[model samples]
Target: MNIKLIAIGKTDNKDLENLTNIYQSRLGFYINFSIEIIPDIKNVKKLSEEQQKQKEGLLILSKLSATDAVILLDENGKQFDSVGFSSYLQKYMNSGIKQLVFVIGGPYGFSPEMYTKANGKLSLSKMTFSHQMIRLFFIEQLYRGFTILRNEPYHHR
Candidate 1:
């Protein structure tokens, strides 16, 4: 199955962008993986938190197709270890989904509509992380999960 990561805004840090790219490239070897970055909202200073989330959510939803199995990367969602995550990936593949989309929302989080549209939610960790840093972490984890599935040495038990 194809896996897509959708996140809002660009990574300003060059190092983080480079590292995220490395993992993204590695993922291509195992599956059809891609990241779609929704440009940051302009003039956020005037918008309320809820307003910003609504605006960002609209952009996020626009990237999705009706057939896409959308999963939100939410802090309050289910958490899984590396092995478990690999199995989770396996389940989706086994289910024959065309594209499994994971989204990382904007600062104030996803809007009500986004939550309603999502098939599920996953938490990388309970601890908060900057959205930019989360991009790198999530991509690396995706790579690790695939390696684990292949019984590669990339992930050591």
Candidate 2:
């Protein structure tokens, strides 16, 4: 199955970009993984928190196809160990998904619609992380998960 990471906004730090690229290349050996960045919404200053989430949710929903299974990366979502995450990936692939999409929502988090539409929600950590930093962390963990699945040396238990 193809795995796609959809996040709102771009990472401006060159160091982080370099790391993200490194892991993306490593992940290519295991899965067809790609990152799609949604442009930041205009006039964010005038919108309330709820309104902002709604607007962002619309843009996010637009990227999804009827056949895609979407998973939201939410703070209150399920937490998985490395091996368990690999198994999770195994399950999805076994289920014969065409494209499995995971989204890292905007600052205010997902709206009601986005939450309801999601097939699952995953949490990397309980603490708050910068949206940009989460992109790096999740992609690295994805690479680590695939490596662990393949019994590669990149991940140590």
TM-score of each: 0.98, 0.97
Best candidate (score: TM-score): 1
Output the worst ten-in-a-row residue range by lDDT, candidate 1. 148-157
> Over 4 Å off in model 1, which ranges?
none
What does candidate 1's lDDT look like per residue over 62-135, in tens digits? 99999999999999888999999999999999998899999999999999999999999999999999999999
lDDT against true structure, model 2: 0.93
After superposition, candidate 2 runs with Cα above 4 Å error: none
Q: What lDDT tens digits, residue by residue, belong to model 2 across residues 16-53?
A: 99999998898899999999999999999999999999
lDDT of each: 0.95, 0.93
Model 2: pairs clashing at backbone N, Cα or C within 3 Å? none
